[model samples]
Target: MDEEQITAAAYNDRSSYAKNRNKKRKSAGNRFLQNAKGFGRKHSFGRGAELEQEEYNYFLEILEALNGMTGDDTEERSTMANNVYAQIRDKEIKACSNQLSSRVLDNLLGFTDEETLQHVMTVFGENFRVVCCDKFASHVLQKTLFIAVLRCIGEMQVDEDKDASECRKKRKSDVGREMDYNLVMDFSPGHRRVCGKFVKKVAKFLLNNLEEFVWDSFGNYVIRQCVSNLAGITELKIGKGNSAEIRKLIVPDKWFKLINEFCSRLLVWPQFPEFPYNEFTSVLLQNILTSLDQTQDKFQMLQIGEKLLNDSFLLKDPEQDQSDERQKLPKVFHRDSSIRLLEVLVSVADPNFFKDQLYKRLFQGNVLLLSQTRATNFSVQKFLDCVSDKHILEHFFSELEVGLEEILQLGHTGVVASLAKACSRLACQQGKFVKLLLEALHCSDATGVKLLTPVLNLMPPEKQSSVQIHLHGSLILQAILDFNKPIKLVTAILETKNDQLAKVFTDPKGSFIVNAFIASKFVGEKSREKLIRHMEGCYMDLALSSHGSRVLELLYESAGSSQKEAIVRELSERVAQLNSKPWGVIINRKLRVEAYRQNPSQWKNSSKAIGGQRAEKIFDDIVDTGSQSKKRK
Candidate 1:
């Protein structure tokens, strides 16, 4: 029974072997169909194009899934949509070729929801290296990183709004206990769980493998995206290294390591033989310098700042013409980065931190060079904004005297503008800087006027003007008028032949200067009174001008009651003929004057000038004018 019965039984099971093989084949086919479901419906013979058409519309399904994730509170459909998302994410992994990855990523990023974003964040963290290093997956990774950043920033803002709302509610409750309210005082718990985690994960992963990422074709882009994200976070108060929130999320040593690693890259960039330097490193450096605030970090930061400065071009002796010095200074490859680093360093420098050698090198050793280098001059303004020491200004003046002509010869309008702005800002805090600047201007013979030449060129040309002056001069003059004892300068300008001062009121560029002069609290009240009287006489001329009209409108805001009445009366006489935009605005101001006069008590509370007081009156006046014009027609 054992041998014969066993042999016979085995022979009888032959059909079962074929059946089992067929069943396995069937199961494999089903798995294939499940993966290709995103690929659209299959086609029979002569329907290949139709199959492709279905596959082409696969993006629509992706979008539909994303819509469910991001869309409204329809609980019934959302459940189905979420199921679609899970299937797409989990089943599509191996089948998500580059093309499909792009489509999925683009749609997901474009229609980000809390759930979909959280899914991406989870996937990104788990397979970060593979995705980021992959040429195809890296694009998705970059876009997802940026979207993650936007999500984090949005959550931070929502938290801020919630806090603000809570504060307001508490204030309201304290004042009125009878009011009952139910408030949503917090963000979704899901958001709280994933919001900060993604950013920290991204930072650590990217920073740890920065070298590998920086060189890979697709990975470089991930590095760029990471740097950009860090740059933005550096500007945020919550993301700063020393912030309490940042302390909770990342240790000081880790934060310092991240920045120090980045800084070291900048210092070593020039040494790389084959790799071309990019501006992204510069951007990252600037942001890092701006973000680091702890006192312990200052010494290392100071060393980095000094390295950037030493690497930069500088003028050694102001007495010797800058031509030789300019020639001696090697052409820097990273001038922009060096200049920006210096700017950030100076802007954020602690007074105590920069009190010694770095201070001297900045203010005295390189002062002449900074003022003359076109790129450095912009940063020079930032330095001057922060520097309070009187000696620095004194040193600047002394150096400026010897190099005034050469500095002017550089012929950059931005340099001149920045110099004027810095000097003006300095003059506000101390009277001595203004005196020094003026004396330098006077002492240079024609170079002082040359310095003001850019200012003079800012004025718009006019047909009736006899003499033209530059508005660049006016920015300087305006600064002087605002903060200086500007009597001498104002008198000298007014005394110019061919009515030069009067021409400023109508010149497009110069008109702003005139307005600045009129509104200045520092321009001796008597000087302002004289200037206003002069403007009042030319009120009609100014109101009719394109740029001058705006200035005249400013005059209406700043002018005294008598000066205002004079302007309104002048505008009233010409309102009928005024059809141009400039003249219409003047007429609008005239309407405000009349409205305020008609209802002083009603207009009294309005802070804004033109439309603030009696908006209805202005409307009525417009209607009345239209009706009158119609009657005449």
Candidate 2:
């Protein structure tokens, strides 16, 4: 507990960090972070390396405890957190390196006073570049920025009121003011000023380090929070003189302009680049562009995509007379990272750009080839996702269907899955797709129809029977079942033998197919009864397994009064046996096993009292909740 007893944090090596930085593409932002000269670093070593390891691991345990501490912003929770905060005050620098310690620190900021926050800001603010480079420390800094964004908005508003009417500043003792603990930032103005000062320092720091933050893996995240979260402080408004209001910017204009410049730089790629693309940069760029798309800035994403895809480096000499070759798009977009970036670009590009330039240049005649290559298969799926026009989607289906079996043979299931979803959405070529799907899975038209088990399991014929179900196969079936109720698939499923059918019921992924079937709008009452009758003997086995219990519940809920009575009666006789398994207790209580065991006649009367209306939440199947919602609505 004594200050003398406190030891230094173990020193971490920046050799790998420096090596990773050298391998990444040269960008202005990364250069600045590389040149920051230990901006947020304080180094001192404790005891021996073994002792330091013990202390570091011990600190992680303490962090876990702090984050797991619960409260509803009550004084008790705050008091408990402060006690922990005091103990860690000496180990503050060391604790920041703990992966999730920031969450506990974040909670502390919300419940504790502004002085505690000021201490945090002052300690960490001095070394933005150094701290932001470590992944875990970056997480803590990001949380601090997020909270500061929310709290400062209120603080800036109060500050603006005083600046606008110089003599009208609200006093701290204003009796009518109420504290809203629900909002962490609606504090006394003095607290607001403290928060405002920290925000100001962050804005200044961000402006100075914009280039270094863009391409550095960990540093890029800090830049994103500043741009997305704290940039809005400029939007605060205040009443000027009489009847008019004007903007009261919290962060200066130069900071925002620099932020814009930083964003614009993220999208640029030269025709012939100096270095290979970095995955971290690709991920960050994707996030920024996606956020732009979501915020209705599609025009920005579209223009950026069009320019990146269309524009290339110019020939040095006009007399070279090779404009076409010089202007040709680079192979950068074909790399795994770039293709993923292109996926987002394709999704948000204008229909004119997507259908015309992309279809002709990237997708038109390359459908099967794209589907065949392992990495490019995703681009094939993206085409299916974005080509919303029936005519375009139809063209895709026609070509993809020709090689459908080949596509399946090669294990490129995502392309197949996306194609199925597209057809279902467009309501074009539904029957043909289903028929083709059979041949594709069977690898022969002659044997396709009878290989339903292989199709359900998404395994080739030799590998089919009881293999765990593929997630994509489940999605495809749910998509098809949503397609106006295909009777061929429905009848085929119902006619399958009980023992074979139970295999699908027991798989975690395959179990959802039962829910989708029962939950689909297409299957009428008689069809439901037929399915239930087929599954009767398998019910007890299904009830005993964990995943199987969910399917058993779905079947019981969808069954008619007669079928419900039968299921309850069967389960009643086996209630003690059913209770032996973990999920058995849940399934038995749900099936009303005890009530049925007490009196069958009484249970029959209760079923009739509901007047044939479907029970609430009973049809809410675990397979795909959206499946039924899509049908009923």
Candidate 3:
């Protein structure tokens, strides 16, 4: 018990202690050599690699633990156990004197085992305080930590066993519960807290020491990932004003630029699987659209506008082809995203920006995709109203005109007509749009004409006149006239009292009214009379031709006893004024031929009916010549 006796006892025990320590070191060395052989089969090694080989062995053991794989390989397993303990004891000393490099961290994160992850975290937490204090450590090490934490957060499970049972139940029994769990898992409070703390640390570190690295090198990717996670986190209702925190962290221009870059990259791949990169890009773009400040950076707004346009085009069902192997996919209107981006662009973008090719593409593309029945019509109307420039408005109208033309060409008459209706709604003072509507009506195919009927009816009476004239002159109108089905054409025309139609019929160059009258003759006396009255005020030339004779025939067929008197009186009045010498001679000859055919004996005695001496001589010559030859026979 005396100090000298205790010192002698300690010295006597020192050899045993040395023996045990040496045996443990030899066992660890042998196990490490075995692991080195395993590693050499998979990976090439460099000089003096044995000392460093212990680190790689430690990393593999940690990965196995994280993966929840524990086994009976006592020698190799004991070596890992001893190394972890040694790392904890010498926490202040650099384990490899190289810090945990990004490459090492990357390899660790790629592990699928949970135990390995936990071990890595354990080792990292032990040395992080010391390693993170160094400036170089803050660079690669902090970023690696941030990424590892994020991956862990993404993979974290609240109750894996319970969730597995629930997932089975959800597939067979309670779908709603499974859906709720799936939604909650991504944004659970515990996950958010863990992710937020890690993100905040990385953000602060970057702000404090690696500001230049962030600004110049990793700035865009880091900001993008953070904002995206923030958006998903906010949706979970985790923390107060997380969006505000994100906004504060990033410059507005840089944020939107990053969003554009992410969105552009997204289109490169056809499908967006549930990967972090995919989710991050989608969620970040959404957040940027939602939080964008139009007043701060107009160019950002324009860029967003361009991005939305590109997205809309890319998401569209590929152009229709009968030979396509893919089944028809639903059209992605993406209305909410598009409208949000458009509103910002309109408010902040220069008036000329609306005229840009991108803007034109979106407005013409998705704006035209709107069904005629929905609120999109109203949205487009409001859009047109908010825009102030005449040239831009004209450009919009011009694009619509082009779209309408395509719709008609494709035989989408209903869509073409609906578009014309939309055009008429564009600021009533927009005369150019009104003109375009009229032209559309004129040139529309049959379906277009049918679709345009409602639009024509909706037009103000004052505007209807010019539109009607345009319709009358259109080739489509001629086709309708020649269609021979008088009812469809009559129904279309009579629906609107177009004053321009009257002018067209009387123009001498347009045949709309004249053709209608001719068609009515075949339709019936009632229809014929109605058309005749419509034309009587404008088409005197049409009334005097065989067209009038046809009208007379219809009158004779359908006239009532009382109607007959009126018809005869009208015909007499018309004939009495027809004083052309050639017309008079032709009428006289027609009357004589009728009399001779009705009564041949009477005609032989009546020279006046047959046209005087010349007519008698011709008849006598033919009869005398024929009788002399036939009587001799």
Candidate 4:
């Protein structure tokens, strides 16, 4: 036989044999849950299936209409949505699974009215277990969940009005909680009824395959969107809702119905210890923890903690004994994947519980050790950030400050950065921290503002053969600037010499010191003015460099009318020189220097103003998420 004939015969034989093997496996109890269906499901269009030419062409026409959609042209949008829905009416599964068509479907979802979206989601629910796990279909499903959440949030805010006493109390609680925590203001009787119905619809889809869903990478992001949006969404409560105000509200506690079910699966998880440690499942667990209420789900939080931290390396201190067993205990936090899970637990954990049960036992004595290692140093930093008690912080400071110099020397300035942030967060003695930081960098004895230079430089003065900047040093300086009693630090900054000031403004990282100082509410107005005066001789120099020009712009925004005039006056003086510099034209126009050249008074009178606080999920770094383009392909 010819070679081509022989090859074709062998390929056909192997394909038939493989099919027989899959059939045998299916009869033996399919372990991979292949083709698992939701109840009575019939329209099972497979994942990434090829589309028929006729359907593909019509969907493209639908896509063209969707892309053309703009404004609140409700009639046209409604017509387009109905036509598209008509195309997919009995074939939702097929429409959702086509890789090219799913992109169009996801956009059409954004344009659909609430009633249409609810119907589409109901169809999604019918085969939620199957379609949510599809590579091509999951994106469309995630987009739908995002819209549902916004609806719930808007609906909850639809109350007729809040009384004055309730308003005052609500404002006080909302203001502080808004800054730090992801709290839902009040899940009062009014809104809980509305949120419960929506949560039920969404959670029902996951319960059938909750375990598989939480661990299914794309599936997990759906849960993350649901929880994170619900947690921080009280932000929307403060907004004037869109033209049609959604007095609809969200119930934060009800989010746990799904979380609790997911956690139950964690207990009997067929995989045991390996399940929580698996990278995908680890992220799912972290997202659930972030949305937990301290009082409502405290037990659940601790239980999940116990499950994750169950191993000796996590729960026990390595130093308690001189055995090899003790040596392995600290290794738990050193792995990149493991450290984040531990940090998430620490952040959500009750302070007293964390300190007594977790912190002192394992991380306390290892402070210096954790700070020096590449991975565990982050754990040290996380601990410092969550710590609030003065005495506990003092105790931590006692250990960390002793090795603070070594930590910096080893290029572990992040540990020091966290310490500075701790000082800002706790309203503790940051002046002392500034002192310790300066002393650690060996500038303690430097004569004056010379100390500030080393910090901005992240190098001791004596060792400076050349000037190089480090970003951490800039962050540390900013944190110090945020301190309540920053006078001591402010004095050092104000004392920065003309030459030193020039160096500060020109360097990309160092120039940020001016913005932080000027923006600081603690610093008096006079300190800011003095800062502008320090830039007087350097305005031409400042406006010429990219970073320096940014400093000039910020100074202008925060500066008084007088400071604005001075900036314009100074820049115009050296306009000719600045016009020739590398970054001049862009900077000049950005700062509106043309106004100074043409008609300065009009610009002076009209001072124009132009304008992720969310903590990352712990397991994000470890996951190998594919790009959207690759997923479609």
Candidate 5:
């Protein structure tokens, strides 16, 4: 045979061996099933008969194999034996097989006595090494051996009645009875060492598989043991690092719940030690406050805040009897918790914390407590002091702005007026007041007036009469100097009938000011004609007042030639329109006589212009007819 053919045959032979090995394993499993059926019929046991028998036989075979090995080969053979034993004694398979065996035993033998079970467990544990040496041993077998050993120990203690006695003693101690000092003193270091090892192994296992363990059937017991171990670990100097490692394994959400529960348990459990409980509770409270503050969910924050406040109140209250020597006390309130709690409460209530009752309780009452408790609480006081700081003024203004917008949205004119008045009071600076007034103006005319009324009311008593005048006068001047359409402002000013303003216009100090304002309208070329028309209107309105003659004299003196011509033409037209009236006749008669006395040329010229004699005779006849008509009547 050539090399290639030889290799091919070898490959075929290996394949055939693998196939046979699988077939044999399957046949063995089938045989166990048959044994289970037979045992069910003969012993009236259904569950674990076959599995347990198979495991026991597997263990016996490994022992036989180890017994046959030579001394020189013993080391290697022993190693193999141990390996097989571990597989046979595995925890997972043992749990399943034990569950099944317990069910079967309960059905057939009516449950094994604790002594009998202890013996069985001991025998299995003692021979597990031989079972583990077998190549047939699997992961399930290893787990089973481990669990079986633990069960043996547990069962032995029960059979000896020591477990119940110890449990009762522990319970009594937990309930406040003094432990027997001599009995505790008699505890062996060996037992303590063994317990330490056991606890370490359990903690390590749980920490490594924490997620899976937490989801398993023994999750509750595992968590309880883990917490107990963690507490124990914290006490030992060597265990501190391990404890930290274990803590690191916990997720934040789970950690929060665990810590909260731990604190609660400490508060309620009679057996909880004071030092550790106090330490852990402080850490837990700090963690909760920090987490609640960091959580951006406002609703969730509010809920947590309420819980914290209630908890804090309970801690601080003197009536709870929580001040006893044995009680684990809460930490002195650091400013952080106090401030955080205050922020949350105020934010949740949506109260104006700067000016509200809630603010007083937190910033004044509780902060005072914190300061008294903590020497380094100055920073905290500063933080709390910010509660009523001037920064709130800005916030108030912003809210005021928002309130105004709301009023506009609701079309609540009355509310708008009230808010405007409120804003004027709050505005301290001239610029701010002016800006607010402008904003009110843009909102509504009535709102502007309402807002202005307060400002007008607030002017210095001596300056009260001048406030409206100054504002109106300034506005009017602005309108004229800017050459804007002044009609709106003029109409508003006139309609208000501000006596202060009227006085200003009449006073010597104010008259020229008013004239200067009117004169600015003529500064624009386009405004000249409009200015002239406006001036004429003003003069006509003044003419009706007692100041008419004074106003005319001032205008005449102030006018340029072109303005003079315009005013003269306006006055002449006024005289011509009024000539038919009694006042006009008297004025004309007076004017004619004055014209003659002042300038005979103008009088002779006026007399000759209209054929004077006929005009005079006509005037005389009209007068005589009037006299005759009066007599006839």
Candidate 6:
């Protein structure tokens, strides 16, 4: 027979055989469907049921094939994973098919192959809400999200590295590489398949509908991931990096509306429907702050900052320059959310506007009342740091003077500490302001002394000395001691007849004051001598106490030769006595070390010097004494 006639007859035979096999298969599928659905139950092939069943079977078959390909060879596994997803690509699955979609996604997550990642990228844009809202499918979407973010970032990083390499090449060679040259050209086709456009679309969609899922029980987590990571994706496209606010790059109007809505919600006490505080909302707020910081619209930042600081969440039309709503402001910012908003404002808002516009509002709003409440004190401290204008600093303190008694009433150790630290910053630039603050403290009634004494009592006598004193008091006092006319304040503090000076030297809370004073560059020799003499009566006693020993060490290190010699002479008689106490041993070692540092030869040759064996003996005694003390107790 001729070759053409033979080929045609063979094709006819094969076609007839395939038709017979398909007929049998169709019959079997129909029988199985009938049995599964039950014969009495009415069934039809409408609503794409036939196509869906076929697709379902095909999906399962692909999954089954991939399940067997789970060997150690990544290339083989990746190929199989890719092939499985390729079959489902662009095929619509019903909402009821979530479990099937989840399985497919989970398998991809396991492989995390480039092809599988690409498939996920496509599916994400196509079925953004379906994937995000699914009970089980959401997990795979989240994992896909992280993978996409990391991959996109990784691509940008590759581009960066290539640029660096190109630069090195240019320097090493004759000419710089052209900017039009694709940096990512060297990557494999597989590596270059990252869907940045799809990622952005998915991100934009998620952000557009952010409010829907931001408070969802499961959706919130996904929203948080999207807000935090998708910004990088957006940044890569825009080349804005961290300096670009998400609001500007994303839907700016929508972003502002979302932030204002949240701020409004924050204004109401005890949220209706009782939503759990989620990272999604917090991250969104942070992004708003970041946007405010990045945008050149100072007026917008000012308005938002004023609203947040004032806790005025009245829904204002964005087009309007100002709102006329005269809502009664809350006395205290009981909401934890407002604190972070205020913190970011203080950190990111224009310092000038904050000092001028908001500073007056803060005082007039009686926001100082926040200091009295533990919940809002941190925000108050943050507000304090923004008071850099000399005029504002003076005015704020002056106004604070009128209400100093009420302000003092709100002073907890922590609250007072924040005030002290704030005052310290003010003291650095505004000496007159600090003097006014101190005078105000001095003139306030008995309650003022009770309030101010904690600060004075805790102030380290010198600048460098550290104490474990109530941190609030210690910092305030440290600020006071660091002032230009410190002696004026010092003399007043010492003359209070409260043993404030001795308390600083002898008491644990006040001992850092001694270190501060001793380390002070301004402290004259006479003052140092007086400090040493005061401790002389309790020289041994102070040497044995934990906090007091630090005082002795500072004295030894800072004292002149004659004064140091006197300190050594007094301690030398008690050096053996110091051996039994930890604090004593510490002081003895300090004295010997300082003396050695001054005159190494003197310490080396002097038999009385506590070195080598003497120091060892003191440590041994300390261990023995501690053990004995423990046993006795």
Instruction: Flag clash pairs in model 3.
Output: 62-116, 65-115, 65-116, 66-113, 66-114, 66-115, 66-116, 67-113, 67-114, 67-115
Give the candidates in order of TM-score, highest first.
Answer: 2, 4, 1, 6, 3, 5
The C-alpha lDDT values of all candidates are 0.52, 0.62, 0.41, 0.65, 0.37, 0.51
lDDT of 4: 0.65
Considering every candidate listed, which one attains the maximal TM-score?
A: 2
What is the C-alpha lDDT profile of model 1 across 1-633, one tens digit per residue? 453353344445544665676556345434433454535444221111122344435544554453333123234333543454565576333323345435454433424346775786787788887777665566667666655554444433444544553454443111111010111223366664475567668777877786676666666666655654544431112222444222111122433555566556656655322122235455545555655543246765776666655554332333344466543332332256555655667776767645554466555665667678776667656665666665665665566556654664565334445455666666633355444444434432333223333236532222214345544455666766666565555664444432344466667667777666776676776766665666555666666666667777776766666676666666656543332343554444454544444555444445234344567788889999999999999
Better of 1 and 3 by TM-score: 1
Better of 2 and 6 by lDDT: 2
TM-score of each: 0.60, 0.70, 0.26, 0.69, 0.18, 0.47
List model 4 lDDT by residue over 1-633, tens digit each: 653354355456556766686456334223212222221033433237766666766665665554444333445755676668767877877788876578667655644554566677778777777677788688788766655554445434434423322343333222222211112233334333333465567666666656667767778777665655555332223322332212223445656566676667666765645544468766666676776642247888877767666542354443455365324555456355567767887888987768886687677777777787877888888888888788788878888877887888888888888888888888786778888888877887664467777787677788777766778888888888889978766787777776677777789888888878987888888888888777777777777777887887888777766777787777766655555554655566677776776787777655533211111333443243545446778
Q: Lowest summed lDDT over 10 consecutive residues: which window, candidate 2?
A: 3-12
**Displacement of the residue 390 alpha carbon in candidate 6, Å:** 1.3
lDDT of 3 by residue, 1-633 (tens): 553353345445555666676555345434544554575456533122132555655555564352332222334433554445445343323433232222223323322133343444455455544444443333334334434444434434345533553444333111122223332233445544544455445444433443233223234344444444432322221123442322121122333443444444443444422111233333444455444442244555456555445544335444555253221212222334333434444444556665564346445544554423243444454455456555555655655665553443334444433333333334322334334444544522343234344233333233354434334233333333333343555545544343444444444434434454454333555655554444333222322333333333443334443343343334334332222222222232333323444564564457344346776899999999999999999
Candidate 6, clashing residue pairs? 417-472, 459-477, 461-513, 461-517, 462-516, 462-517, 504-510
**What is the per-residue lDDT of model 5 for residues 117-198, given as tens digits with 9 covering 90 to 100?**
2333444344433323222222223323222222223322332344333443433121111111111222344433343344
What pairs collide in candidate 1?
455-470, 455-471, 455-472, 455-473, 456-470, 456-473, 457-470
**Global CA lDDT computed for model 3:** 0.41
Which candidate wins on lDDT? 4
- List runs of model 5 lying over 4 Å from the truth: 1-277, 292-295, 314-316, 319-359, 365-382, 385-633
